[model samples]
Every structure is written in structure tokens, then in C-alpha cells.
Target: MSRKRLLPALALLAFVAGCGANAAADDSAKLSLDAPLPTAVPDGAKIVVGDPATEVALKLSGQYDKVSKYVQFANLSGGPQTTEAFRAHALDLGSVAEIPPIHATWTGLHVKIVASKFRQDPLNHPIYKLGVAPGVSVKTFGDLRGKKIAYSPGQAQGALILKVLKKAGLTKDDVKLVELPSTGDVYAQALAGKQVDVAPIGGVQIKRYLAKYGKDGASTIDHGLRDDAGHLYGPVESLEDPAKAAAIRAYVAAWGVAQEWIDKHPKEWIEGYYVKNQGLSAADGQWLVDNAGHPDIPADWSDAIQRQQETIELLAQETGNKVIEAKDLYDLRFQTVAADAIKGGAK
Candidate 1:
């Protein structure tokens, strides 16, 4: 080829490459948080939700069938599984605490929380209590110093440990943090086996932990910190889709109604959810219900957002993660969706 012809060919190749790079950049661009959300769920709209507890609540309340057409409830929960699903585009929405959203942001997966719920009296109804291993002396938070504590970095339980330490006027250097997965009965098992001096244990595991190991000197003490941060979050890409956004809006409202139903119909919830679905005894179910107090879904997320900011700051400091804005992690368009749904009596 002549030199002039070759030069033109190279220029064309460069132009094409630039266009391809720009297209890729557009694909990964962040969705505008202020973008208008469609009020109505379009026909054939669908979302894969990973919230089993909510699934049970909806089923027990007889509200599942109403949203089943557009909502596919996957038997998936926790930060790890939910984040993986989000990465794979397998999950449209996930139920998790504040930590997952923060962690997701840090790991380059932008997510936004669409709904938030807290216990009516969060401090009194904390989701977790510190479980002390047999023969380990940890009567108070101060005693956590120099003791081995179970920690799961990207999980709420691990974040709770850091919060507990902060409340006690201690730092990570003050305690030996034992890296562990806070899944199922792992925390309880670790406590019983004396693998760690302390760990945060919640739900039925709290009762069973003390029951099975109480004689062996295992005990749980209230951490006295409010850890009731429940949220429904999705990847930015998923929430950006108009159909999925509308479906999520509807699901949030139904979720609020289901929560109210559970609070009102404790016996039914205990029987249908804890007893039959989870295989727990009726007594255990009652214990969980009494301890959970009542659900508090606030229309204003100001307080929640402020608390999340503090959490992000703390986690960022401890983990060397970038301190991102907590307000950006929430979609204010959904600020009142659940509350309005509950108020409208939409069963």
C-alpha cells in the first residue's frame, strides 16, 4: 500500500476505536439519582427479589399472590449472596442492612436503597446480642479489650462489632478480631467451641446458643446499641430500568402492608413463618416476635441517612475504604412509598 493510503487507514482505525471506548463509557455511566421513577408498573414487568423473610410475611399475610405476577422471590439473603447476585444480574432487589450498600459502593458496584425499616424501639429491640464463649469473661463492653471477637468485614455483624468497640471507647487494636463468616449458626458454633471469645448472635440462634451451652457457661449480653437497619437495595443498573423501578415501588408498598400484618397477626406469623416455614417451635417463634417489637417504616429518611453516614465513616476509617456520601446511597423518590402504601390500606 502507498504511504498516504496506509495513513488514512490508520486514522480510520483510530476513529473507530475512540467511538467504541465512548460507547463503553456510556454503558458504565452512573444513573442520575434524581431521575423520575414511573409510578405504574408496566405490563410484563418482573423483578427477582432476594428477601425470604419478606416472602414468608407476604405469604402469611395473603399478599404474596397479588405481587407474584411481577415479583419473583428468590430464596437468597445476606450481603455476600446478594452482592454476588447483583454482580451477575441475577437479583433485581435484595434485603440487607446498611453495610452491604456501603460495601457494594466501595467494591465498585453502585447500589441504592429503595426502602428502609427499623424496630419501633431499636435500642431495646436490637437484632443482635454479644455472645460470650464458655469460660470467657466479658461482662461488659469494656471487657472486649484484648479478647478475640468474630468479624465478617463486608457484613452487618462485622460492622456491629466495630460499632460495639467504638461505643466501648475501644479500637480494633484493643481487641483480637477473628475473621469469620456470620452465616446461619456459625457464630453460635464458634462461641460454643471457644473459637472466639465473643461474637454477635441473633434470631433463634440466640435462644439455642444459650440453651445448648448455658450449662457450659455460655451467655449473651445486650450490646445496648441499635442495630435494626433493614433495607431493600438494588444495583444502579437494575433500579434505572423503568419497569423494574415501578415493580420495586409496588413491592415496597406491599412489604409495608405485610409488615403491619405480621405485627397485628403475631400468632399467624409465628405459625406460618417461624414454626412451619423455619421449623422452629411455637415457643421460639413467640420469643422472636416479642423481642422484635414493632416495625417502624418512616417516611422521612433523614435520620436513617444521618446514621448511615456515621456508619460509612466508621467502616471507611477501619477498612481504609473511600468515604462515600451516604445520601447518594438512598433513592429519595422511595422515601414515602412504603409509608403511603401502609396508610392506603392496600392489602
Candidate 2:
């Protein structure tokens, strides 16, 4: 979970592309991948990605060549894992969320913003629901003020829930906050014959629950977080000033390839990228793409800069932390390179 601001052109691009960033891996060669370039990529533009440690991400080059620039990657896997990696000086660039970096920044992990990343549409209101076990008599957020809830505390959705609770006139102290290790299937251990009355289950988990329980889904569990909006993913690195600037250049160069491919093959994207994955049903994946994505490209770094400012304000208020100035969080010189590639055709 990274943070980003919405550029006006990005908003416009959303309207035009009608698909969100980070939707699916491109699977065609027709992808131009280098339309909006600021300059010709240097002969040695390479980047390192230490993201959520997903095997899919580690293997992204198979889906698109633009990502080849990221020839080296380190998987921090996530949570304190990524934070530790950053602190140990194992990574140059990684995408992270607000709270972790806020803490990391104090520990000498200086983060530099690369570009605007993906965010769930606040307006669209994604399908985030609250789930409860068999005997837990909870109906609304207010009902569980004193009940114990399980989530990946202090990150992504966990942070969002903290903000939501505060706004709802409740605090983390109001309920028992059990920090689940991560957000995957192993969560079953919590609910397996244990008094795990609550958990932050998602679509992946929900489907499994329904199939195993009664094929009808539990009736007690309902929607947890409703106001679906936040700055999502981005590329950031803990590097010396000189090295950070170098990584931004490489990412911008690669993003140029990704965006052009999306722009050029607008029609085939959902079908090609979504259908390629074995785990995702083509139909369901297509629906996810249609409902949540917008692929229209950004016109300039200025637009992303404005987005960074807006996101910083929202995040600061939400987290009760000091707001980082836009200039402090992001650098646009790399994006200038991307914009140039888009307009002049990739060099």
C-alpha cells in the first residue's frame, strides 16, 4: 500500500482509460510501451523493486518488458519485513504505505516518490465487507465497540479502519485489536474452532468461506469499511540523494513503456491480462477490471505533484502525524522524462 495524489490529467485519463493503474499484466507485443518519454532511456537504466514479495510481482517481466529495467528485486514480503529491509539498507526502491514510512523516515529511511500509484476508487465504493463468525452478534461498527476484532494492525486496511473508527467516535481502545500476521488464507487458524469472533476478511477469503461453510456465505458478517478511498501504491527508495534520483529516472523510463502499452492496446487489456492468470476466472477478473480500473495516462509531473500534496494532507489528518510537504515526498524530474517519452515517442 503506497500513497499518491490524483493529477487532473490522471482524472481525465481515468475517464478515458476507464481502468485503474496496476490492473493486469500486459500480454501482447503490440504494446508500444514507450510513447511518453522525457528522453531516450540511458543504456544502463536499471531499477530494483522490493515490493510486497509477491511471486507474481517478482515474475512481472514475463508479462511486460518495460519491467525488465527492474532486473534486480528483493522481496521484503511485507509488514515489519519491508521496514526492516529498508532500515538494513537492502533496497533502493520499494512501495509502501503511510504509517510504515512515517516511522521509517525517522530511522534514516529517506523515501523519494517516483510516480502516482493505484488507489481504490473512493467514489465507486469497492466491495469491502465486515465478516463475523457463527455466534458473534455484531451488526454495525458501533455494535463491536467492545468486541475483539482481528486485522493486519497498523498497515493498509488496518490503518484505514483506525481512521474510520476515530471518525465514528470510537478509538482502538474501544475494541480489542488483534493484529493478524497478514491478509491471506492462513487466517483460517484464527477462526478454526477458536473464539475468533471477528476478522478483516476479503473477497479471496470470503469466497473460500462461502464454499466451505454452506455455499450461501455467513449471514452475520457484513460490510466493515465503506468509504473506499486512499492513496494506494507507489515506488519509493531509501537511498543517498544521488542514488534516489537515479532510481526515479529508471522507474519513469519503465513506466513510459507500461503506459504506452496500455494506451495503444486499450481494447484488449482486460481480456489479455486478466485472462492470462490461472487463478482468476476470466469473467470475474474482467468485472474487477471494468469496475475498478482507469488507464488514461498522466500528462506531467506537475499533475502528480498536486496529487501528492492532496494525499499528504488526507494521510496526515487520518494518521494524526506530521504532513510531509509535496516537495519533500516527490520528485518530478523523472516524470518529466516519462512525459517526454509519451509525447515524443520513447527514445
Candidate 3:
């Protein structure tokens, strides 16, 4: 069926199911940063791997239905709005890959780690690379010294570059990092013209420029990028996990379904969610839909928790703030569903 038709049915289902949320309940959400969102944590929910609740509300970063397909997972508008909701507790479940939630833990927010969305290599995402014009001879991370790198500030991918650079024996001091605002396209355009030595590309844009696009536009200076896995694992934090583990399973299950859908019907997925909804070109959207990490969500919450802790520690160091422990921020009890559902396949 066409997505246009599917959406109406989904919208009707959501309305019938009464799953939508009132954005008005979150007037303060607009002003504050995202805190841990509150969720209906059912008591004594069995720790069945991979079975998080299906009907819970969520505060997703970008529009998720473009990928997930299920309707009415009430959330903040998109990235910026959802982020603020996480800060304000206007949401019960929120997803972010880095920085925001890491900082939230320090303030003693109600957020807790329930589950994770693992990307094979975050650096490979167009959102995370340094794109150079064809004229630039910068092919490796070593060439970034004294070159201008433009990107959004404090984002996980940006910080990841710094982290990896430090591992590579460099730091922010090695390059001139230019902070851009909403118009990262302007930044990319700047890179294409060599105005900026390197314009950081995130998500599949990195893939597009590196593998698909012609050299006439842009190319990756793959020096600092770690193929460690080109995908990223976004942490889903929530407050009140009465079902704790079970809730996670449901989410993961649905995620798998959504991923399978993307694979089986790539064109529909791109058209319905990416090109039209996200306002990107078909090529850009296709790059995203095709390349997204479809690995099964890890049932072993410990690995994700540890990674989050590392991210938090990094955040603390960056901000010079008091420390926040992984144990304190992660509410394992809420992920009973995820614990119950995972069955060993993660790419």
C-alpha cells in the first residue's frame, strides 16, 4: 500500500488507540534542556529479553516513523525540540546518541538508560566526517592541522572526532573547528568551495560524498575517522520502568520490524519518511535508508551502559563538571522487554 494511504490508517489507529500526546503539557519543555523522560514502568515486569512495551510514549530525536513506521509514539517535534523535552521531562522516553543525555546525568535528572540503537560505525555517518573539496590534498586526519573544520558544537559526532583525534595524538588544538548553526548545508557548500578547509558531514551524507557522489562536489578526509563501525548506538533513556526490561523488548521488536520493512521496501521507506517528510533529496534519503544500522538491539545492556559512562566521563571532562556514574544514570530494570527479546543477531 502507498505510504500516503498507510499514514491515514496509522493516524486513525493512533487516534483510536488514543496514543497521541499534548505538546502543551510541555510548555516548559520549550525552554529547558532534555532531562530523563517519565514512562509507565509497570511493576514486576518479567525480564524477558527483547519485549519492551509497544504502547508507551517516546521523545525521539528526529522523526522516527520515517524509519519505525508505527504511529503515535508521542515525542517532541524533532531533534532540537525533542532534546529540550529530554531536559524538561516532558517526555517519558527520549533518544540521543551523545552529549545531551550525558550531561543530564550530572544534574541528577530522572533519565535512565533502558535500551540502545547501535550503529556499525558512527564516523561513517554523513553527520560525522570532515568533507573536503576536490582541490584539497587532505586525505588523512593528519592533514587537518591548522585547517578550518566546520560543524555543530557539542554534538556527539563532533566530540567523537575530538576523542578519536586525542587517540590519534591530536586535539581541538590541531584544527580550527568552526561552529555552524542550523544550516549545515551552507557549511557543506563552503567546504565544496574550499572556503572551509573541512566541513563535517553527518549520517549518510558522509557515505554519499565518500562513495556515491562525484569528486566534483566533495570527498572525505578519512584521516581521523575510525571504521570501528560506521554506525552509532543512540541511548534511549526513560523514567519509571515498571516493566523495566519488558518495555525495552517491545521497542526492540518494533525496531526490528521497522528495519526489516526498510530492507524489504526501501523505496517506500525512503519516499514516505525521508525524501518527503525530512525534506531531503531522494538520493540523500536513499543513502540514509539503505545505510542505517539494522543490527538487532543488544539485549546485554551492560555494554551500552559502559559506553554511556565513557561518554559521560568525557562530557564531564569537557565541561569540567562533577562526575556522573553509569550505574546512576542507567535504569536496567526498565529494559526487561529488551532483555527478554534479543536473540543474538546484531550486525
Top candidate by TM-score: 1
Q: On a 0 to 100 scale, what is the lDDT of residue 103 in model 3? A: 51
- Which prediction has the highest lDDT against the true structure? 1
Tens-digit lDDT string for candidate 3 (1-347): 23364445435433543311223233333312133323333443222111112222111222243313323244222234334444433344544555545555455444545555555554443235567866676766677778777755445555565665666666677777777642335656666666677776666566656654444645765444432211111123222232332234345444444443445566766666566566778888777765564444554567666766776676566568776777665545434444343342221
1 or 3: which has the higher lDDT? 1
What total of clashing residue pairs does each candidate reach?
Answer: 0, 22, 64
- Poorest 10 consecutive residues by lDDT, candidate 1: 16-25
The lDDT per prediction is: 0.85, 0.47, 0.48
| Candidate 2 overall lDDT versus native | 0.47
Better of 1 and 2 by TM-score: 1
Candidate 2 Cα deviation (angstroms), residue 129: 3.3
lDDT per residue as tens, model 1, 54-133: 89988877788989988877766778777776665567788998699999889889888999999998889989999999
TM-score of 1: 0.90
Model 3 Cα RMSD, 1 decimal: 9.4
Candidate 2 per-residue lDDT, tens place, 1-347, comes to: 22132233223333432321112123232212222323334454443455432224224424334545533444433445555544443444555544454445534555555544333343353434455665566677777787776666445546555655665688777887776764456444465434455665543455555456523234334443442322212224222222333444555545555555554553455445445543556655555545544443354546545544554565566557677776565544444555555576533
Off by over 4 Å in 2: 1-45, 51-70, 75-79, 106-108, 125-128, 188-195, 214-244, 256-284, 287-291, 295-327, 332-347
Better of 2 and 3 by lDDT: 3
lDDT accuracy of residue 17 in candidate 1: 25
